[model samples]
Target chain A: MISPSQVEVDRDKGNFHYDTDYSFDAGIGLSEDVIRYISEVKEEDPWVLDFRLKALKTFEKKPMPTHWATEDLKNINFDVIRYYLAKGQKPSRTWDEVPDDVKNTFERLGIPEQERKFLAGVEAQFDSEAAYSRMNEELEKEGVIFVGSTEGLKEHPEIFRKWFGKVIPTSDNKFSALNSAVFSGGSFIYIPPGVKLAQPLQAYFRINAENFGQFERTLIIADEGSEVMYMEGCTAPKFETSTLHSAVVELVALKGAKIQYVTVQNWSNNVFNLVTKRALAEEEAEVRWIDCNIGSRLTMKYPGVILRGRKARGEVVSIALANDGQHQDTGAKMVHAADETSSNVVSKSISIGEGRSSYRGLVQMPGHLKGCKNNTECDALLINNNSQTDTYPAITVQGDANSVQHEASVSKVSAEQIFYMQQRGLGEAEAMSLCVNGFVNDLIREFPMEYSVELKRLIDLEMEGSVG
Target chain B: MNSLKIENLQASIEDKAILHGLSLEIPKGEVHAIMGPNGSGKSTLAKVLSGHPSYKVDGGSATLDEENILGLEPDEISRLGLFLAFQYPMEVPGVTIANFIRAARNARLPEGEKVKAVDFYKELYEHMDDLGMDRKFTARSLNDGFSGGEKKRCEILQMSMLSPKYCILDETDSGLDIDALRVVSEGVNRMRNPDRGILVITHYQRLLEYIVPDYVHVMSEGKIVRTGGKELALELEERGYDWIKQEAVA
Candidate 1:
């Protein structure tokens, strides 16, 4: 467990790193040999190794989606990026047993303190593997299984093999294929039926190696009548050359079950964060995604939900902030396949300096589905003249009984408003921050208390030097 | 020495001169009123003193208690104990009045020392009641979609809460009915103490009846052309501004 005084955790202060001396390092570039090396090192089952080999072929066959994505995607040279780097294969069950360097990094991130305060379980992943993973004794007694992906695959093959690639397959997209080929260190959680955890399970992903690509695969399953919440945070030190982070997260909610997934990623401007997250909800089940993206050079993520059973509900609440030299392309997607299914999406974005932000949403209700309802609202705030924002919503509703509503708006922080607040004793930056917070006030209230406070502080730090 | 003294204040906006070498003084323990016609630069004076970015001060020396405030930022001037109640308060959507005022108050406190929440709310409610405002207004957005009279009362609410050394009310009486005028005037009158100075800028003499001024100055074109006592307001209301314009030309 780490103390509060040992950490100076400012995600924007990107100068922190620990010396790396990994015993296993699969040099640079992507090849069958590299994938084989990773599978061989993990001692994975033959089927899992076969899956990786096939996914590597899929990754090689697909091209970068530069037609819709930013041209910056072309700048990434896959041949030079280190595919895998890890200290060891297995994660320690206790913090004291972890290596000193890895433990120090997580300590500086305040993960142990957070675990002690509110988290029921914690997994701190340093690079390609988790350094420490633990859950509460009471939760373990309740048959809740929480561990890193490596352990989950080897130890709980019966459950893991059932829903491993059922929700989001490797063929879902190019990034998903890439992730499936060389993925490591993410959480695999299973909440037993009728067991409702009071505290959330947390995972912290830290990218410590330079010129490295971190691909973490996460899967969460909530059984019938169970409820669970999972949160993940990602950060990396600034590197001279750009780094890559492509992760795949899939969720499953059984009948009468509820699952909430929250993510707050504040990567350095030198990292490209592209992730795929989706959830499948059965009869009377609910799934909610709360996402906040603060820092990244280019981030393209659209968390989605597939409503598969009657009376299933889905929701997505997202807030993205793009500062100078950053592009945050994010939104939500909902696919209704059952009668009486419903979904809602609310997204807010702030663009400062020369940053650009866009919202691309997709909502579909086929002709067979009846009594389906979908509502989406996206609002954008531009802080400077050079800031840019865009929205592209694709909605297809066929059945007359199905309905969809969408609203979007773009607003700027006016000079007069800033002056008026300044006359009331607020500094220029403070005034801007207040207006921005107010713009996203209604949506921010939905965030938890701890996250809302941290979000406000992060916005204040980004608002500095925003005004002349 | 303890006054808001302006000497040869020259100002303009967008290359168009609005105030041509205007000057006035409002010392402590006094309230002054400036009556002017349309485009007479009365509003410009309020903006110039508060460091509005649109208005440029070509040449002037405005001081508060011997500290020059011409080149200071708007927030700096505000922290120096000067408050401006805008005629049209900009609407800050989603920012509740309570939080907005609390931020202003927090800015005045020393570092790391915060206002007690209970005591602050108590004082705020009392002030809101004095202005005849509903207690629920504290939770509403700041001046967003508020009625004309409600906006005026909110301005007065902020003035009383800030309790600055000098207060400038720009057209505070405009767009208000008689009943609202009285409630707003009472809110201002409560802030009238020996340690503060108030400057009221209005186009008509209607507001002067409720909040009587110690001195009255008539502004024509860009500068003050007549100075008198409170009786001058009655005279102007009877004769209108035509006579004052004629007198200033002569």
Candidate 2:
């Protein structure tokens, strides 16, 4: 554990490569043989193999999405991506038990140190499996289960099987189907009734290999009256070839329970981040997605929620920054299935240089649901003349007497605003950062304190010398 | 000695001429006031001196203690001990007053050295108290939704925190109430020292009554038409700017 005196605000320290002795490799391409190889290495049952094969068939049948940003989506070549690579290691309760190379990689990312200081639990996923995962003694005593997905399915099948694919099925989207077919390391968290953890649990997903695909399937279930916050962070080294990160996350909050799922994705600009995340909120339950996207060549993610019971609430507070050579097409979806359910979506984006950021949202409310309210706000800021942003918010409100309001705005940073801060002793770049920070300050506050500070520093780095 | 000097300063916005061959010299330990009517280039002089990008300096030079500040960025000129309190302060949403001032102060420091947090807050609270600003103003976004008087008081608070060697208050008295004007004047009065110079530009004489200047100059056509002692402000208040324009003609 790193003491408080040794902590500094630093992350993503560039590429760190090593000569890894791979214990298992599925090589490139996806087929029945590759699926069989992954299942054989994991020693999974025949039923699990059947699930992977069925999902693989679905993934092959689903056509590429041509509705939005199809040109960027066409750049991804599934044939070239290596499906799985695991550095032989089971989950270690202690940090020292991990291998030297994996240990060095995580120490640079400050995983164990953060767990010691603030987090209730920490799970570090290297390539295909969890390298280290541990929870606090108090949380363990309170019947909180925090472990890898494979371990969860093997040990706690009764709880895991019930909510596995209930929130999001395999055929939800093309990427989700791809993830279900070859999914590997991801977090599986369970909290019993009335057990409210004081700190958040975080999983840091790191991709170290070239032309690799990281398909992490995360499932979290909050029991009745329980509350928890699960944070997911991503980073990868710079490679000449493209990398793929397609994750499927499903969350279930039982009656009177609350859950918050936050994602701070800082993948290298060479990677494609296509993810499907959704949650099911029961009676009086609340779920939120606080997402911040910074570095990615292309990202298409829209985390949604299905309000399953009366008085359930959902919210998506997100901020996306797209610098040069990046496109972030991300938003939220809210479905009002139960009466008196409420939801809100606030999305803010910044596009600088030749970058592009967009907001694509969907809100659906049926006619029978009364008193269902939803509010959606999307705001975008363009840094330079060449930058671009778009908003496609589709709202369907039926005969029900529900109130659904949507507001959006697209604006460029005015020269006057920049000059105002500049006159107060900030240089042009500093002024630009201040403006961008101001644009998304309210939503960024929704994040945890540590991540909020890091997000500001990341924006400052992106805005460095970005003027035309 | 610390000083700000401008010689034959000609500036313009777009194609129109604003400041035509303006000349002024303000030495250390003195407060100079310039009273002008609207469209007489009073605010333009402040913007040009602060290196506003929209204003083009056609000719002449502005120097802060022997260093030419015309071609430098606004921040560079500001760090060289030149401060311009804008006539209409822009509202920057989500940037708190505390952090903005801290960034400005940190920008003036040498590389790798940080301003001590304890000292910064202590000095900031003291300045806010003198300005009659609420303590909560520190956390609020700078000038966002501020009343006219609140905006001026905030600008004064910033000026006190920055402590530039040369201070320029352009039309600081335009939107102030009587009570706010007195509080703002007290805040400015507390910062007076032997090594720092102040230049106050206003269209009205009410502000001059509170913070009396060492010399009062009347600008008619971008240049100083007349100069005199403190009594000149009272004369201008009674006779109006027509006397000054006619004096230039005569």
Candidate 3:
């Protein structure tokens, strides 16, 4: 019989690390000077420096949100974390020109291979700055601007300035404030009106340094009647101490436009991943957030959407898996402000070993809105008796004509189920994997073909240690 | 020599003795029927032989073609060409019938080898049609919401797909209707070849009338008390099991 490791193992795929000598470092602390040093190193405008300085103050003024969050938040030491580190100020336009160490890291992660196969553009981020960024020439000629946020702010100020932090403002939460203060090396995309791209753009974020924080800022603006799909991936090597990854993503879908954003993050267990993502949809527009979170010590993210114009739609399809010593606290939020708006939220989670998963959601419709509808379904699967799952959904709907529905369920992979599959000649691990794949079968279909296969493989690796 | 041999098989569940030193054997090219009353340990024998986790075999040995299978895992037992049609099939939600059966078929193949999808579907459709099951049932979850007859037909479908050397039908005719029983019996009849040993456990004589076993064994309390031909089933059906119990006691 073939062991699980022989079938393209993933547990060791992201565990390797490389050493690099960074040319730029913003010291190890959070202060006004450090923020100024970052803004000056990037050679930003004076107004941008002011923005960073103000965000630093906000980050310090806000307290850690530990009331409802895990007590592990006290373990994060902001004083010792290196705020920013990069090899250079500018990203290499070609893969050949990138530094050998950074290039080799991305190569091992299969970034170049994926770019060659299906992606229209590829951005590889190392620590504090983008190392390699490229896009299709054909797309550039069609007025699609796909570049790093540094380049976007420097080149296309008129378009980037209008919606940089509009969707998720820095003052919205403590993590958002922290990300706004030290954000770097995230994708900035703008699809012009009436241009519908058939291919997706991808970005890969890698955290290479120890005792560091990687804060990325992403923004996508789909103009009127335009459509685009953007996907991002993240990974980090295991560290003895803790690391931090805080990102803020904002999406704006204009009238009659569509935008779909997908993210699959696999961080090491020593990393704390706290992110804020949201979208603003206009009349007849659609915005979808497809997110999958795996392998992290603590993750607290709730991707949301605001239906601002009449007849707008929003959706969030999420899958979160928490293994040993991990907690995945994820969900979605929807706010209906106009007439005839609709939204759907479907989330599934799996907790194995001593892992814990929680789904917290909110859906609100004011009294004046008419013909607005919302539907939410949350399901959780427990793999062991020690594993835990919880659901906390807060829904409020008013007005006689509006409608809302919510459903929640919790299931366990019973011994009988496992025995039944074993009786059919499947080994214990194979039976467990099949049962898991079956539980998330319908949701996995929503992912792209390539990612669905990888997701199944990753789950198989997670189940290897699950059988006791 | 090629047979399922049980020697003084003793078993229990939850510290309660159920099968007390019951011994039986079914050689190749023969069909055996075990008829008993409610508490006579008919189903326990099947569970014990299949190595169900709940039952503990205190003492004895069971062999499939001279290979000991008393303590092996259920999957290992199954891979050795022993198939037990469960009395109550499990409902595995969201696992489609096709994929479930394909997993079983794939497990039998050598490592790194897979069953060709086209051939698997062709054979599955043929067996499903023979059992009068709907063609669309392949996409449905494995016995998730199926009726009793449909569940029975699915069990038989799995049995036919695996094609084990030894088959044990544990009360396969309990919930089947008249028409379903006929179709199921026909399906079992088609699988009755000289290389296989079939054991049917039932509380009534109705199912045996269709399959027509070669040997009829009357079980009382846990042991087989009387061994006879197919005519013995008709005699018991005409009379009752009380005389058999009295005879065993006497």
Off by over 4 Å in 3: A1-10
TM-score of 3: 0.97
Q: Write the per-residue lDDT of candidate 3 for residues A1-468, one digit (tens) a residue.
A: 112122222477678888899999999988888888888888888877777777888989998989877788888999999989998757888999998988999999899998898989989999989999898999999999988888898899899999998899889999999988888889999999999989899999999999999999999999999999999989999989899999999999999999999888889899999999999999999999999998889999999999999999999999999888889999999999899999999999999888899999999999999999999999999988888999999898887989999999999988877777777788878888988888889988888777888888888888886874
Candidate 1 backbone collisions, by pair: none
How good is the docking of model 3, by CAPRI class?
Answer: medium
RMSD of 2: 4.6
In the range A136-251, model 1's lDDT, one tens digit per residue, is 99999999999988889999989878999788899888899999999987989999999998888999999999999999999999999899999888999987999999999999
> In candidate 1, residue B74 scores what lDDT?
95
DockQ of each: 0.61, 0.49, 0.55
lDDT of 1 at A310: 97
Tens digit per residue, CA lDDT, model 1, B1-250: 8999998899999999999888899998899999989999999999999999889999978999889999789999999999999999999988999999999999999987778889999999999888889999999999999998999999989989999999999999999999999999998899999999999999889999999999999998889989999999999999989998998889
How do the residues B14-95 of candidate 3 rate in per-residue lDDT, one tens digit apiece? Answer: 9998887888899978999999888899999988888788899999899999999999988999899889888888888889
lDDT computed for candidate 2: 0.88
**Per-model C-alpha lDDT, please?**
0.90, 0.88, 0.90
